[model samples]
Target: MVEGEGVTARQASFGGRGARLLLRWCAVSCWLVVPIPAVVLFTTDVPWWAGVPIQALVLLLILPIGIALWFDADQHREDTGRLLRAGRPAVAEVVELELVDPGDGSADTAVLRLRISGDDVPPFEATYRGSADPEFRPGALLHATVDPADNLFVLRNLHRS
Candidate 1:
């Protein structure tokens, strides 16, 4: 997205717990089915083909989780774009944004301290992005285009930084 003037700019937020929950769900479902096939194979002389249905069932169950993960990524990008496209053209002075990773790489996030008002005024801090920015400092202001609807997003402008 183009860095326009009014929107707030920052990095993306990571989905830490949500991703874990999905992964766990996938794991548990797979585990639950593992024994069923073993039990069927050992106890019954029924053809090995009997287990195909069980495997298919497991696959069908996990499909939604996979679909949700894809949708999640798409939604994130869309939301980020929406924030970038929201407000009037304004430049928000950048401040040091801290990033935290909750082990599951997806939850890594950055909290940027932004000067919403004037340079001398107190700045606002919000959690927005999920990655690290080596160039940003405590007082270094970055030129960002913000959307008034949500001023927390900033279209990344490498040239201005």
Candidate 2:
């Protein structure tokens, strides 16, 4: 029942068309998420181009987009929190699991394809890409919370520390 006890699938939110558009915006255009760091260079006392102020123009251009994204992410976080609080319990059976970075020197993580079915909740398949925990084995039944929106679910109580 405690929050974030288990490894939750962050990809659950990337279910619909919105995420694809977000990815496209970040990839094809390079307009939205890429300018955040360039804008930072202007804020520091460090000389822009050692004499030229190229960073100034870049900052002026990208600051607006950064602000917009920051506000958007903050609001989305709030909304997701609300849904998780009101979510219903469900069980997810891992149909497949694959570790993406086994020896890459990063944290143990994997992509999990799970089939979710619960009482009064329609069955659906979701691919979860996150921390690779021992609890998430193929055919393992994991606990989760089904969002009222019926599209996303958060895993819980996997390996509480």
Candidate 3:
């Protein structure tokens, strides 16, 4: 989770690539779903004056939602790339954990408060969802990375050996 500086970037509990794909699909679907029926209705039965305004209203409502999803996906992609390319390893102790039940019968998620150990790095928290790992329990040591520019943007490399 990225905090401070007025913009907080939270890493999704789910996989970042999965989230990006879902967002991209949703944005594309919005373009296909909302406008096609709208166009057909306007051309077949609606008057020009009424149809134009209605179309404009619908576009105004949905465009922002689509744009926001796309922007978020793009941001996630950029962050993931950056983290993979330039992130440095740091040992982090699990200081806290909050288990969250998604309520859909999926595995529970653990929200972690990690105290990163090293010089020039500060403690931060991140929420992760998936099957519970005993390695992530409080006081357990885990491998993680901190964004060089902002220590708050910590990325836990779950696959670390």
Q: What is the alpha-carbon lDDT for the whole of candidate 1?
A: 0.53
Q: Is candidate 1 or candidate 3 better by lDDT?
A: 3
Please report how far candidate 2 places residue 130 from its true position, in Å. 0.9
For all candidates in order, the CA lDDT equals: 0.53, 0.62, 0.66
lDDT of 3 at 145: 66
Best by lDDT: 3
lDDT of 3 at 150: 56
lDDT, candidate 1, 79-143, per-residue tens: 55554445333445556567777687575565666665323222344434535666565776655
Candidate with the larger TM-score of 2 and 3 = 3
Q: For model 1, state the Cα shift of residue 121 in Å.
A: 15
Candidate 1 lowest-lDDT run of ten: 118-127
Scored against the true structure, residue 72 in model 1 reaches a CA lDDT of: 65
